[model samples]
Target: MLTHTKFDSEAIANHITNWLHDYATNAKVKGFVVGISGGIDSALTSTLCARTGLPTLCLEMPIHQADSHVSRAKEHVKNLQARFSNVSSEEVDLTSTFAHFKEQVPQAGTQHLTDLTLANTRSRLRMVTLYYFAGIHNALVAGTGNKVEDFGVGFYTKYGDGGVDVSPIADLTKTEVRILARHLNVPDSILVAKPTDGLFGDDRSDEDQIGATYEELEWAMQQNDSGKVAADFTGREKEVFEIYKRLNTINQHKMQPIPVCKIPLNLT
Candidate 1:
């Protein structure tokens, strides 16, 4: 785990809240629309948006979601609405929609490949639902990605959860999100629950998919930044470094800007 040097959590929280408020005020949008995934990141994000005193819409878009995940999402929404007057929620069940989509697409692929694609499809469906609400409400889509997930591991779906109007917590680490979430009095259920993307309709966590905990990944990310390569450490450290490198290398397309082909002046 990354060691903290005792910074002010309240100040950071207020800063984010003010930043979100300022962004919305300037953008001339109504408020923020966030997808609640029953996870800490979304919980904290919705809370921050609510603190902005701007309208914050929390959408529960579940596609073959686990009961536990659904319940926790509901729990967070209820708690958020109770605490903030600006916060509101809606549940849009996407199970049938996903089934219909599967029927529309061809089914000539392998099961693993199909499952992975469908998992991404679930995220994209939620993205579509969020934008639909955002469009109707005239609000921006707030992203719930933390620094480790967004930058360190590239563990989000491009044009899905990654498709957002603003990222409030993208600079904060997973550990920092947890700490600030507690200070903001986020529900204990969310704070204590393991972190999972919940895209596969199972309880498998991000660590299960990434082969390392957020702490290990965070440390690896820092080491990787300091120009340290895999040859620097042996044992588990080396394994983690390689995993981090592999993910960062492959997911660069998501983190970087889209490629655009430019016509040369000679051709023009």
Candidate 2:
């Protein structure tokens, strides 16, 4: 038996669309900048940005982004551009740039970049690309993170995908995001596609990296935060819940504001 959560997708979509508009207008930004990764979160966020009726730059910064992923991203952008005049897209492949950096940058003694470090660098490179367009267009970068990655498990690279000018879906859970995506008419393929950061340079689903399904993770999050692990939970459920808790604890720093040094009053 699966747990069912109910929400009004239309209402949520409307609220988020308005929120993006107001946030950008108040900041005097000209438009929204989004990195479309061919994932549901980015697909939904990009759609909402288009709904704002402001210029939107949907950038596909592929640092070895998979072929299927690139194709899906292009399809989504094409669909959006056809339906909305404000939406535009570009594909900026960074594979060569990434290779150049790895080859040219001097490595410290016994300090070569690890695979995870290189993956994170890929994300940071994408962030930089988004900001490059944003700076030129006077736009804000719209993040694709959902509540689970943004707050619960904090499963995002710092200053990478985590670095954004505004997060329109940060408050919505992964489950709710899918609901909203349906309402927004995100392409069926993207809506049902397995979630991934596309940072591995290979095909690796987010669940494979996280060690648990989003549904299980979401349940664990709600149960743990509620202070009541369900008495009827099986051994597997308990194990999954514990995994979620461990990840949430380990990655909590990603969810917090950057630490700032405060001077003593007298010293100041």
Give the top-scoring candidate (lDDT). Answer: 1
Q: Which candidate number would show the highest TM-score if scored against the true structure? A: 1
lDDT of 2 by residue, 148-209 (tens): 88888888999999999999999888888888888888899898889998998777999998
* TM-scores, one per candidate: 0.98, 0.93
In candidate 2, list every pair of residues with a backbone clash: none
Cα lDDT for residue 129, candidate 2: 92
Q: Report RMSD for candidate 2.
A: 2.4
**lDDT, candidate 2, residue 64?**
77
Worst 10 residues of 2 by lDDT: 105-114
* Candidate 1 lDDT trough over 10 residues, lowest sum: 1-10
Per-residue error at 237 for model 1, in Å?
0.6
Clashes of each: 0, 0
Report the number of backbone clashes for model 1: 0
lDDT of 1 by residue, 1-268 (tens): 5787785899999999999999999999999999999999999999999999999999999888898899999999999999999898999999999999999998646998888888888999999999999999999999999998899879999999999999999999999999999999999989999999999999999999999989899999999999999999999999999999999999999999999999999999
Which regions of candidate 2 deviate over 4 angstroms?
A: 1-6, 105-113, 229-234, 266-268
